[model samples]
Target: MATQTLHRGRLIDHLQLVVNDLESSRRFYAAVFDVLGVPIGGSGEDYFWADELFVSSAASRAAQGALTGRHHLAFQARDRAMVDAFHRAALAHGGRDNGAPGERAYHPGYYAAFVLDPDGNNIEAVHHGDADRSAASVEISF
Candidate 1:
């Protein structure tokens, strides 16, 4: 697979979801992320990650306590076409449709699609129209 990286904003460093079945979650996310042009970061026997989102089984030390409730996570899509592709790919790989692809009332040119992952997390792919940017993301050097 080709390597792809997403530009990160300052607010979120990372997010994790504790899932009942790691394999199922892996398949679901892998297919969706592929459409968004992001590559899987890595994986282990109990965990798999893409970009800043980590999915792991309860057996992993980071998820040994309890599984979390549903959460909403939205990923930025490069364009409306990518958002549509993401929705289709997600459904083909164990995701259920929460909302179909279309313009949302959130704001002008807010095209998005929502899907429920294997663990019932509300995942979304959104395109905020077109805009100019100084840079894709800010790079912090350690």
Candidate 2:
């Protein structure tokens, strides 16, 4: 028998979201992601910057847009075109557009799109290609 190597799939391993309220945020994400809430552990007042878990300052709360909990988590698209596909699927899945597919000049080769997952948390699908990478290479081989 010959030894063979295994290939690990490429996908999100873990994510972190910063939210205004924990419980409320969990509810929103649950509905959006279509998954039950799973406790992430560590509950108490130490979760926030000022150690005030109950009170979200007016500025912070307002900036959160819709949901009070975690804002956004991004995933890599399988390819450049998949970014658009994800955007369309997201919209069909009740996601609102935050950003459309385009190059982010600030970040080199940053190609991505942003969508709000029913709860106003920004969900993104991105493909980081070279800054100069363009779709112009696509030509009919025939």
List lDDT for all candidates, in order: 0.89, 0.52
How many clashes in candidate 2? 2
RMSD of each: 3.4, 13.7
Locate the minimum summed-lDDT window of 10 residues in model 2: 46-55
Quality of model 1 by C-alpha lDDT:
0.89
> Pairing residues by index, what is the TM-score of model 2?
0.47
Model 1 residue pairs with clashes: none
Give the number of the best model, judged by lDDT: 1
Off by over 4 Å in 2: 1-13, 16-68, 130-142
The residue-by-residue lDDT of candidate 2 on 5-53, one tens digit each, is 3222334333444554555544443343332112232334323221111
Q: Candidate 1, TM-score vs. the true structure?
A: 0.90
